[model samples]
Target: MSYLQKPSYYTISLVVVLLLPFTILFASFLLPFSAYLRGPPPIAAGSVVAGGCSHGAADGGGGGGGGGGVRPEISILVGVHTMAKKHSRRHLVRMAYAVQQTAALRGAARVDVRFALCARPMPPEHRAFVALEARAYGDVMLIDCDESPDKGKTGSSAEDVTTGTWLNMGNKAKNRVNIFPRMYDFKGVKPEDFLEDTIGVHQLKQDLRWAQTLEHFNVTWLDPSSKMTNSLLS
Candidate 1:
């Protein structure tokens, strides 16, 4: 008998070798399954990707980038009378051109230009003036007051002066008294029988102010006697 026999080195080495393969296999299987058993994967990485997407959108990238474009800032309405004096007609046409050029310079995407004309018997020169003005400005609208029920009204006063009268008047006045007859009305419509009350200087000013209030444009009235100044349009 003698001291207790020590474990053999060979036996210990054999045991380690046998366990190595099982340990590797167990580790391989446990890794993926363990993650599943622990519930969903961590959100930090996914959150980072989502955060990047949101940041791009806010920076005007991705599908939302188109919103970065600028919109039009102004619109113009020019009231022209076909029966106006030769000088007056020419002045209005020149004013319309100036307005269009100014709008282009100001980076406006649109100009809602309208011409109000008396439909009674327009002179040939006046018709020619309208054609030239229309060619200069892409958007042209004509209103023929003769066909309008509101025609022949004294002093630009609405036939019905109630709270919603202006709206009704605007609706009914649609191009009935428009300036460009050829552009707006294909079928020659005549102005209503109503007579327009003559407007005075003070009345004209008041009407202009009222019109300015209704439009989004920066109103610039060009008088026939005034010299044409590009700076004023700017």
Candidate 2:
């Protein structure tokens, strides 16, 4: 135990010799797995699609750890026909894991997930309850569809059932989502009639508007150093 005792070297060498076999055994397994894991640098997520748009370079994750970057003015709207005293699936979407891909795919700096429920004839109590949740979560966007059919049971028009909505983009960019309402070109699908198709002309129009408005705002990465490229499209 002296300051420069050489006997300690003997002990250290012996320890190294004892551990060598185990180290070699671990490496024998680790190297092969590592090479398999490193076989190919994954294709960057920039080449992936978002909202069916063939993307080159989105401002977010660029596709690996972060995925495509974020769209500044990203608005996700889910319309519910009924609001209950208890929390509904809509609330689950806002509060939990729903609509994750919309934000993840774009790699946006800011995200606004909201609900567009009609404001007419909703029981005062229900409105108040929803208002409380909105104030708490800041995730409710009310719509005055004002159509209450059959004793105001199913309020709101067919058009308002679940309309595509938009989130105002804060900045400007050409690469903003610009893929919608193409009557002539429907994502390579030449529908005989876009208006009568499963994706109605109205929906297509809304999609076009959503894409246009979202594109107007500039999308930025909340974190600059992240390397996550591919985003989940769920």
Candidate 3:
């Protein structure tokens, strides 16, 4: 250790050799317990929500990265009756403010937005468009229902869907809400609005009666009394 006895290569090598095995052993031991000290934080509700992804496995993949193997918690059956090749109602539903809210709920909750529409006999051009939308968005359930369209306000068409298909759609998710479109601006229906929240949307019931004129139509009361207090009425 004297100043005159400056350290040489051998001395350095000797020290490193003595510490190498202990260093390796220490790292090996620390590896197993490190995860315990730096473990993941406790699970928080909605942190791992299904999340309404504009792309629900759009890559043709099955599930999300973190939400692997998790099925949709809520199923939304939205009926889309195509009035014609260019149905304004269908387009409006896609871009509605309520639709945005529904997407938010989907992302935060296990809710799935599905549209029940008649795909068959759709104009070839419209059919292509339907396919494009279906491919892009993991929503919309199109079926082949035998029905006719309307002309200058004359005709009728039942939803083009089989009971089995409808039932299968219902069975996909744990809980579900069947939303009647044409009554709402958009598929922006939420489980909360009708099931629990009961504040925003004014849901209609089949309690009212309807008649078959030139075309079949829905007639229902302004729920919770026909006062029109709900925002939907406004």
Candidate 4:
């Protein structure tokens, strides 16, 4: 009777082997269920509202009662220095084309991208290129130092090349103080509230520092390199 009552070690081991897989499977299913039940109720309101807002704009219906409608307009200003010459013009034109194409692909009703050329005597070649490009896209404008009313007469002393003078002229022109900034206007559109120094390479560090000042004024500094467009799109 004692021998019969003694459970065989092999039998006990076999019983455990049969139950172990089931135990693990049960735990795998139950643990997640326990976590789901114990954790905070699904963040319903926050996630729901956020999702609604995101789709609302895409569906043309925002909280403002409009459904599946167009998004607000975005103004992009591409500022180029005269030293860039033909290269700058080509780069800017390509950028404008890309911007327009991107906007169209994104389903924007309108995307206004403009190039603001800042330099002295406005290169004749640049002006011609801009004119030709503008006819096709109407996204380029030439802003020359001579256009600034504050620019002194040609006969004056050797011409000031200081950054301060260059920036001062820009501020004045943008503010419509010395001259009316009419280089680019679309449907009575004012210039972009933000400004970017599209100068890179030549004076890399100095250009960056000058751009920093513009940033202080809440302007964005776009890299002058053509690669920037690709980076931005990516």
Q: Against the true structure, whose TM-score is highest?
A: 3
The true-structure Cα RMSD of candidate 4 reads 23.0
Per-residue lDDT of model 4, residues 100-122, tens digit only:
24334445333333444444655
lDDT score, candidate 1: 0.41
Tens digits of per-residue lDDT for model 1, 1-234: 545777689988999999999999999999999898889665542121212223222212111111234645543343333332243434444453444354244355333333444444556886676555444433223444553335542234543364246557667544334333222211111233111331111122243443432232333555655557555655
TM-score of every model versus the real structure: 0.29, 0.29, 0.34, 0.27
Compared with the true structure, what per-residue lDDT tens digits does model 2 show for residues 50-102? 22222322122121123344434544323344444444545544432222336
Q: Report the Cα lDDT for residue 193, model 4.
A: 33
Cα displacement (Å) at residue 139, model 1:
5.8
Estimate the TM-score for candidate 4: 0.27
- Over 88-148, each residue of candidate 3 has an lDDT whose tens digit, in order, gives 4444444432323443454444433345565456887777776665555545455556434
Residue runs of model 4 more than 4 Å from their true location after superposition: 1-84, 87-89, 92-105, 108-111, 118-124, 147-234
Candidate 1 wrongly placed segments (more than 4 Å): 1-69, 73-111, 138-140, 144-234
lDDT (Cα, 0-100) at 1 in candidate 4: 61
The weakest ten consecutive residues by lDDT in model 4 span 58-67
- What stretches of model 2 exceed 4 Å from their correct place? 1-86, 98-109, 147-234
lDDT of 3 at 3: 81
